[model samples]
Target: MSEYRVLVVEDSPTMRQLIVFALKRIRNLQIEEAGDGVGGLKKLSAHKFDLVVTDINMPIMDGLKLVSLIRNDPQYKDVPVVVITTEGAIEDRDRALALGANEYITKPIQTARILEVAKKMLGV
Candidate 1:
């Protein structure tokens, strides 16, 4: 199987673990974790990731800013981003999409749903 790298950015350790656990079920996937958006950006600079799954409410920098930065950076501009957050409003969803997030998932997320989305995004 081809190897794929995925980055999970979330301030909550439990949430991050949950995401990583779900992602681990996919064959040949290498997962990386970041506590916040700044760390996520650092990882992005150090290595290329096939997909980025981030939570919006992180400290230092929020996921929206990260999405915007990723969209602006030519190297990562084409990379797929999935925003997972507690923000369920239409505006929040629209803003994330406007900032170039490929997919938006609200909190209380199902592992199966996230797994499905991740697989679809990675084309696994």
Candidate 2:
């Protein structure tokens, strides 16, 4: 079986735990957690990841900025990003998508939905 690495970026410990727990359901996945976008970028720099699941609102840096940075970097440009955020507004969703987020999921996320999206993005 092939192994995949995933980075989960969220400031809230509880929310991060929930996301991590949900992601653990997938087979052959090695997940990492980052409390904020700056940390996420550091992890991205240190290691390659198959996918990134992030929240829009965070201290220091936000998910949209992270997505934009990831998109701009040649090394990580093609990597898929899923933004799971409390920003449910259409403009927020549109901005995330425009910033190269492959998937944009609103907050109060369904674990099943995240799993489905992650599987599809990773081709697992």
TM-score of each: 0.95, 0.95
What local lDDT score does residue 120 receive in model 1, on the 0 to 100 scale? 98
Q: What's the lDDT for all of these models?
A: 0.92, 0.91
lDDT of 2: 0.91
lDDT (Cα, 0-100) at 69 in candidate 2: 98
Instruction: Show where candidate 1 strays beyond 4 Å.
Output: none
Weakest lDDT window of 10 consecutive positions for candidate 2:
84-93
Clashing pairs in 2: none
Top lDDT prediction, candidate number:
1
